[model samples]
Target: MKRFIKSRGGMTGFVLLAFLILIGLAGPLLVPFRDAGRHWHDIEYWQDSPAAVPPVWVRGPWNAGKLARSGRLQGKDPVLFESEGGGGRAVWRFMLSKEAKPMRLDLILVIGGEGKRPVLVSSVGDDGAETEVARRLFEVSVGQPARLALSLDGARALTVTEYLLPGETARDSPSIVLVGQVSGLLGTDVSKRDIFTGIVLGLRWALLLGVAVSFLTVMTGIVLGISAACWGGWVDTALNRIYEFFALMPILPFLIVLSAVYKPSLWAFAGLALLFFWTKAFKPVYSMALQIREEGYIEAGKSIGAGKMRRAFVYVLPALLPYGFAVMALSVPGIIMYEAGISMLGLGDGTVVTWGQMLHDALVQGAVINRLWWWILPPGLMIALTGITFALLGRGFERVWSPDRGSRPTGAGPSRSGT
Candidate 1:
């Protein structure tokens, strides 16, 4: 571990990977919407949020343009005035702060009653100009709730724009609820889903897929390679043939076809990835196993009646473990990329929130054409950083385990004096 951190690349990779892991573990807790991961694709859940807005931090200290922030004013605190025939007027005066220069606004009114009521929603500006934003006849059952959504972006865009001017205050009457313009740490997507939440949730999936696939593949490879080398003859020939077949297979095309046909879940896709990935470390492990088998220790074990399985498991496996760790670390980036590529093509599991799925959505929704950099850049940068993290860690492991490091192979037995 000390040696691994001594290298600048390895230290940087460790810090980066640790930061990513920390986000995966702790980010969701810090986010305002804890259930964003579950409701990411549910448009209704995100209905109150602004669509396709940049992050709040973009405003910076300069206070660039008038950026709208999401806010809601419920009817619970309305000032009521009694009128004739039991019909009354409820007014909600919400101050639009000098900082909240909204580009657009939405008013949602929830009315619960037995008969139709003529509701007039108006906005009051600092100049005492009262503009009627929306007027509607809200009909509701005795207990049932009816929702009316009125966008100030339509014909009233000019009226609302004046009210939202910087350094001015505005008020909405009759319990008008304003929803969305810009919100959240990373802002909202076209669907109004929080991008930061999606990215944070995606970290776990990325790490899981990368680590799980790499571990399974490398372990399988090491076991099979050792078995083939130790048992030799028919076992060696058959295993090598299988390894070669998988090694030469066009995995991407095959995965695409299979995924298109089956539409498998993330775990299923991981299993599919493992089928080909296991071959990556096979040749190297096989060569090393062959060398270990030829070592004098193996002859000593055999003379002492040590079985083939015992020798392979108790002796050979340990020596190859360092190499296995190096290969596993190296293999993670490729596995992650493979999953991301499939996901970007829309062949990945749809139910999960992943970096690749985010990219795919960005592509389909024309994020680039619309210049929604927040949507595309975060996931892309994360994928790149993750790849770099594992690559550097793998290099560090390679440095430690390389034969040129002058460390004796563990399978060579202890020192002569100790022996």
Candidate 2:
């Protein structure tokens, strides 16, 4: 243990892994927001009252008469969306040209008034879908930079920026939506419940499944490998060849075939990974058993009238424990990575939440395109860290057990000294 901590790489990997696991475990409780899916249900909180309606002929203080000849401004567009961060926000980009051909840009805005709702139109190109900008009243103003509420489709909403005058507000404004009684918006308690909760819950499920699967596979493999190794000759040869054949077989084609036949459940993927890699420890165990079997104590046990089973197990099995554990520690990372790869390819169980699945969603659901950083980064880091932990544990064990490096287990010298 001291050696493990003293090793820089091992310590670093262990710390990173621990931090990631803790975040995955506790993140749900700390989430500040609610379900991103829950929306609609309450609208009154963000609605505008009727009295503050805007009068016609309003224009920006700078371009009051710019559009006067064409028509008088009837009303300003309701703050369609306030930036999520706060203040006026702009998602759609439009350049105001300084060229002689165009003078000043006058925005014809329609805002929602008390009793009257305006139709939202997203600007073409670069900006998101044209959406209804919500305001407290039907009003028009040219010079002031005020908050705009976005009336998103159904119950969802977003806020962006609309600037008529350059100096009135900076190019960056807070995009805020009128969080009303909507289930997922700020006004709705449901909307504000907590996003991290769900994510943490998801991570919990993932870790549970991952650990359970890995433990089962390794334990089973250890038992089978030990059995094959201790009982050499025909028994060992047959088992060794079988394991070797499986190890050599191409797994991709088989994975594709199986995934095509049925939905990839967590157990199914775990089973597949075990099928491919369980035998990895077979060769190591077989070698250990052969060495231990040639030990004087093993022969001595037989000479002392111990039963065949007792001699094989009592003398040889205990000697293999340290080596078996070391192999297991090494294999754990590979198993986890295999599961993650399968999930990333969209062959994971629908019910299980894994880092790979998260990344798959990021890709398939266009989280990248939407720039949803939270959706993709956390899960990825979790998977990576889990793998690192097992790898570090394996390396540490190796350093403590290597014949050329660390001391051998007591009594192992004579029993395993010959072979």
lDDT (tens digit, per residue) of candidate 1 on 134-227: 6677666764556777765322222211112233232232333455556777877899888888888888899988998999999999999999
Number of the predicted model whose lDDT against the real structure is largest: 1
Clashes of each: 0, 40
Model 1 whole-model lDDT (C-alpha atoms): 0.76
TM-score, per-candidate, Cα-based? 0.82, 0.57
RMSD of 2: 14.8
In the range 1-419, model 2's lDDT, one tens digit per residue, is: 66666666666656765775787666644543333223212233223211111112233555542322221122323343444455543243333222323332223333321222222234322233444444342233443333343222222213333433222333322222222211211111121222233345455555665566656656566566667766667877888788878888888778867976898887777778777766766676666666666677777777888875785666766776666666766676666666667777887765654556656655786667765555556566656666777677667666555635544443344544565
Tell me how far the alpha carbon of residue 64 in candidate 1 is from the true structure, in angstroms, after superposition.
4.2
User: Which stretches of candidate 1 lie above 4 Å from their native place?
Assistant: 61-65, 73-91, 99-120, 127-146, 150-181, 403-408, 415-419
- The whole-model C-alpha lDDT of candidate 2 against the native structure comes to 0.51
What is the C-alpha RMSD, rounded to one decimal, of candidate 1? 6.3
